[model samples]
Target: MKILITGGTGLIGRRLTLLLQKKGHQVVYLSRKKENIKDVIVYKWDISAGYIEPEALENIDYIVHLAGAGIADKRWTEERKQEIIDSRIQPIVLLKKYLQEKNNSIKGFISASGISCYGTDTGEARLDEHSLFGDDFLAYCCKLWEEETRNFTPARRTASIRTGVVLSREGGALPKMMLPVKWGVGSSFGDGRQWMSWIHIDDICQLYLQCIEDENITGPFNAVAPAPIRNAAFVATAAKVLKRPFWAPAVPAFVLKLLLGEMSAVLLGGNYIINKRMAEELSFNYQYPELETALQDLLK
Candidate 1:
């Protein structure tokens, strides 16, 4: 199979590309810059101008859309929020237009969504794919992201993965969480009872692969592990795995709010999301279902 990936240089995209290549599938990248990328044939795409290199779509069997700006990369000013949505929606609009115009045999389209679709805070309620979407800015962003995928015509199969907090040593939240712990000043945010749905880096990559390979799998699927941990337990476990002292008081909510503004909701609030479709419908096996096992693999 020949696959084309957007945001192919990102954390998840980079690992997924290697996995597909190791399995003997041809991988190509649709990047903003065609230069400086080695070992892969990169095709340039400019989302702002609604342009995609015509040859990039040639002979491509599958496409994984992971091309979105980092949601937490900046303060959620009105302008930054618009960029977050545009970064995700514009790519789909461009690709959908091209897919409609081009005569290609693209079998599947898999795109990235976030668990934040459920909301910043669900307290202890367990959420599945069919649950009501949250009424916050984050949920609004994910809703728009997933809605655009429905119009990807001509693709036989389309799946939108609502991914959880990916625990990776190389990037994402794990390293930042590990940083303060390594300094013995690690602490949970808020009161520390917020439920965090998390997945190991490898498990998430395999989930994406499953969506790509399994024609029976379509629609929205949660990419979280079966077990969800509280924020306090998550930090304590990380400290234990790193052999560091966990003795700091929880960070006060007011301080976080003052520091991060609207972005503070992500750290101070969380939801309990379930991988019901992945576990029951697909019978997927996770490499790291438990937080301790996941941390051990990444930290120790």
Candidate 2:
């Protein structure tokens, strides 16, 4: 299969590309940078200017739309928020327009959606793909992103992997979570009862591979681990795995609000997201099913 991946230089995209290649699939990246990498072909695209190299789309059998501004990268000012929305929405619009113009119909369109679309949970309960849409900034952003993806209807099949906090040793939330624990100054945000629906990075990539190949697996599927842990438990597990002490008190919610503004929602609140559809229908056996085991393997 010939796959064209947007934002292929990102942590998830970079790893996903290699995994696809190992399976004997041809992978090309649409990047902002045009640097020559060994076997990987890099094509350039200017999102703001609405331009992408036409060759990138030629002979592309599958497209994994991973391109987007990091939600938690900066404070969510009005400008930053628009950037987040545009970064996700514009890419979809651009891709659809280009594919239509070329009369290209791919096998499927796989995109990266966030579990935050379920919104911050007020109570600890298992949430699924059918859960109510989150009304927060992250949720709103995800909705718009996914909505744009729907534009490819009647022409191409699509699958949106509603991903959770992807745990990775290279990058993602795991490294930041490990840092405080390593210093023995680890703590949780707020009361620490907020649910964290997480998945091992390997599992996330595997899930994407499944979405790419399986035509029946369509719509929004929660890409998360089976066990959902509390923020406090998450902190303790990281501490235990790192062989460090957890002595610090929980960070006050008010302090976090003052520090992060609207972005505090990502840390201060979380959903009890479950991979019900993915597990039962797709039968995805997670590489790291439990939090402690995932931590031990990554931290060790």
Candidate 3:
């Protein structure tokens, strides 16, 4: 299989590329800069200019669309919000047009969607694929992001992975959480009871590979661990793994609001997301099914 990936330099993309390559799949990465890597092809394209070198589309069998502006990069000002939307929507529009023009023989189009579409803050409800869309900015962004990919239509089999907080040792939430915990300042956010749905990075990559091979898996599937833990529990688990005390009082919501602005809702929010479909249909074997175990392995 010849797979082309956008945002291939990102945490998940970088790891996914290596795994796919190890499995003997030909991977091509779309980038803004040119760099050489073994057993992989890199193509340069300026997505904002609406130009994707024609040759880049040649013999491409699968497309994993992970290009987007980081939601938490800066305060969610109106301008910053638009940047988040454009970074995701523009690439999809370009890819759709490119596929239509080339009449490409692509088998599948796998897009990266977020569980945030379920809502900014979750209640006691365990969000599944059928949950109502949230009215928040993150929800709106994800809705439009997924909708843009739908334009691929009848020609290509499409699957959208509504991913949760991916737990990895290299970067992301784990490291930030670990830093404070290492200093024994680890604490939970808000009331410390909000549910957090997460998955191991390895599980996420495996699911993406499964989507490539499984023809029946289509539409939005939650890519999260089966177990959903409270924010407080997650903090305690991290503390335990680092052998630090988890006795700090929870951070007040007002402090988070002042610090993160609109983005604070992400910290205050909780969702019990379940991978019901993935388990029933795909039978994914998780490498890190428990939170404590995941934290221990990642920290070590």
Cα lDDT computed for each candidate against the true fold: 0.90, 0.87, 0.88
The clash tally of candidate 2 reads 0
Question: For model 2, how does the per-residue alpha-carbon lDDT over 1-300 read when each residue is reduced to its tens digit?
Answer: 999889888888888988998999999999887978767899999988889998889888888999888988999899999998898888888888888887778888888889988776546767888888878778888898788776675236888889898988999888988788888999999999898889988899999998887878778999999999999999998998888999899999999999999888888897888888987898888889999999888888
| Model 1 residue 239 distance off true place after TM-score fit, in angstroms | 0.6
Error of 3 at 227 (Å): 0.6
Model 3 steric clash pairs: none
Where does candidate 3 stray beyond 4 Å? none
What lDDT tens digits, residue by residue, belong to model 3 across residues 1-300? Answer: 899999998888988998899898989989888889777789988987899877888888889998888888799899999999999889888888887776665888899999999887878987788888899888998899888776676236888899899999888788887788899988999998999999999989999999987878788899999999999999998988888999989999999999999899988998899898898888889999998888878888
Error of 2 at 199 (Å): 0.5
TM-score per candidate? 0.98, 0.97, 0.97
Off by over 4 Å in 2: none
Please report the candidate that would top lDDT against the real structure: 1
What local lDDT score does residue 6 receive in model 2, on the 0 to 100 scale? Answer: 90
Give the winner by TM-score: 1
Clashing pairs in 1: none
